[model samples]
Target: MVDVAQHIRIFDQKPADELVPKRTAAIKDLASKLTGPKDVDGLMKMASNLVAAAKFDKKLPEELAQEATASIKKQSPAFVREGRDLELSTIALLAMLGAIDGGTKQGIIERLNFLSAGVWLGLSFQQPNKESRIEALRVEVLHAARDYVARGAENARERKAPALGAPLKPENTNLGEVVSNLRASVERLNRNAVVDREEIDFLWWSVTKWSSALDGLYDEASAYSAAIAFGLDGGARLRRMPLDVHKHLVLRRIRAAEPVSLAGLIAAVGDDRLRILTKIPDASTARTNPEIFPVMSSLLSGSAPKSASKDLQSVEAWTVRALLEATALGLINQHEV
Candidate 1:
């Protein structure tokens, strides 16, 4: 389903706080959060997601995924390469950093937490043992940078930012020709002969859903999260995930809402963030947005179909609770935007 509300680019730049002592204090607070080990579950979940991201959609072969990841690392410190395998790790890392830049202490802390978790997770999956995890972190920071590169590439492509150019420089040049070719290769590999706007919407939904909570208590995970949830501990594996589940459920609720409009839907959800999501022109602006029909049909009639609660008829609670219930049942993850 199309979300009419636009999304704030994660890379948007905001002015720095002008306070003096407060800024210094914020840095200390952020450091405390990053250097401490208080959130074990968060660390583990982050680790699993990074590993699972290295294996997203179960698409790219394992060895190749590793190589793509490595190539990315050789080029950038964060992500590996484009294509299905590195999608989640790449995007998450970029969005995390892009949003964190010289902001408040809280923002800096949040960014650091995610980054540390990402590094730990990357090591957890690549190393064969715990002892090796530390050893790898010490020895292979540069040797392994696919996840970092992947992050840069995605941010560059989505925001039309300048290229990393020749490998590691993250400034002032567009990777236009490079991004176009990479996108073409990925689509070709998918057997998607023609990637129109709808297809872009589909993949956008697929990738954006990679976000998850650090721990089960506070954060939520989705199919993208589950796909890359595998970690070095080998505790969590990618369970069977139904594609199009979230798209279907969301559209179903919207259609169920009489006199639906993008503005109204945002009003109902009450999430300010929804307003920032990039608009889906192909699916949302069309007469009746007919493109949503097929996607909606698959949801209502699919083998594991579940109906929305009568309570869900309203736009007031667009919490994606139904989807979370499915995640609880192992059908899908909590993909709330």
Candidate 2:
């Protein structure tokens, strides 16, 4: 396997402060050589050469220099291509300078890989066929949201435990800011109405659901690991799970006359039972958990409760109604009886 950590360090660690000017000058000299679009290939070659020069001039390790050269070769094409419309060339040059200065050559390359994919994917979805384009973008948005949520949950798990003398600080993942940014993006996208409204709505709803789930997980220490595992598993499942299966899940919730909040659903099944349902069972253990299986089956199959307290019932009703609206809006598909 590629040594990702080593690669990350190639760009992440900053160079000596006094050497910064020399690094900047070197990058600028290379950038100045690119006269036009046709010069992109030559410019990439020049960047590789610069890396080689830096190994000796800056006393950088030979391995780091080689990795940096590889990164420039791999990421320079995309930067050059995008530079046609935007100041991507300048941006790329500046990034390269920073990578060299910071010794994060591999990190810069990996980041550029993601950036290149995003740029091309965005352009692809901006085609004339609006319906198909919107659908494609929706899938991308879903995957992005899932990845963000799972990564956030995982990070929360890895947070260091406070010392005995220290007060235990709450886990602060900066999730609120992230959610705010997502909402702003959704609002901006909605203003032009370039994409399907239903697709945008679904994206917005997913963001809210994820934010709420993360908040709940952050507050409950005992449930954190289980919830994070469930979320990560669900995100993985979403990628390959059939569209029909998702429709079925949504349809089951929609069929309930009363609302069914996620909390209510959890309560009905019990947390331990819900946790078991989310878990992947080994072949030997799968059939042995007969009682646990029925709980999951019943939770999915049962209608909304009629006799719950007014407050709980209200929450349930709101939840179910939201699903109904989502189905009607085509955010969630309603399966025919």
Candidate 3:
């Protein structure tokens, strides 16, 4: 009586008519089997057992089946297939892996929250809440994504996203307050000379815009390097470029604060994949997202100049100059990871 095939279609959002009885029967069958407490642990078990049995009986592929098995160890393989596409499957896989590997429910929740931040960021851009803070973040992400897309050789049709960067000061953008990201974009414009602005003050501001964007670039570059400095081996994809990422990061961090070692950076940020780890926070005192990605992207875009090199000489140059400001504040400290 359980119309399993019809139920799959219904859950998957496939159009199905004339299967009311069948769908009802399938739902009843599922309800009958689920008789215990409906907590996360129980839910996980229920889904995992069902998916694991399917895997063994159906003999899924090594990679997929392996993921299925790992999911079973935590809660359920149903999660993998339940998602609309591979993206959700990827998220589910990570979640299940975390659950199995002794990650607490709280930790799992945090990871899940982290995953959802991008969604919220996108939504915030589309329709920000009353709070100007939310609007601020929306602008940052839109600006970042737009600038990155503009730099790529992709078509305008493929690259067009909604305009998101609101002027921090619509009436008057103080030279000191220009976001590093926008500054970099403007600089790229100047370097490329896409069009020349006649106004000298405007041109000067544009130069500054590019400079701030460079800072963002260095922020991200350093974060990625920080991840490398930590133990990320062949994990996240590296940028397709000729930039000396590590040296760039080292220099950038030194500039941000005084001369912190690789260990010190690891201490401050906790990882090098500043590119990914760098998230836009809720504008607390702490800078949440790694400061390097926006900056690195800017510096690397639109025929920008390259990094100094991978040599210690370049590293030393960064340490002395960039970190000079941080040293004044006593923020930089040498320590081991």
Candidate whose lDDT is highest: 2
| TM-scores of all predicted structures | 0.21, 0.18, 0.18
lDDT of each: 0.29, 0.31, 0.29
lDDT of 1 at 286: 15
* Displacement of the residue 209 alpha carbon in candidate 2, Å: 30
- Among all windows of 10 consecutive residues in model 1, the one with the lowest summed lDDT is 1-10
Q: What TM-score does prediction 3 earn?
A: 0.18
lDDT of 3 by residue, 1-337 (tens): 2233432442244544533433333333333333232433333233332222221123333344444334343443243443333222222222322222331222112222221222222222132335343234334333432333222312211212233344667566653555665666665555334212222322343223112212243334553243222211111111111123322433333333344333333344433323322321111111211122212222123111233122222334323222221211111011111
Residue pairs clashing, model 2: 10-103, 10-104, 10-105, 11-103, 11-104, 11-105, 12-104, 13-102, 259-316, 259-317
lDDT of 1 by residue, 1-337 (tens): 1110111111112423432232233333332332233443333343334344332234443432453344334434553345434232333332233323322332112333333324432433232323332233222332233234334323323323233323323562546756766666665444332223334544454334333321221114322222112110011111211124433533332223343222333233233123212111112211121111211122222211132112212331222322321222221121111
Clashes of each: 25, 10, 27
| Model 3 ranges off by over 4 Å | 1-69, 72-115, 118-337
Best by TM-score: 1
**Window of ten residues with lowest summed lDDT in model 3:** 328-337
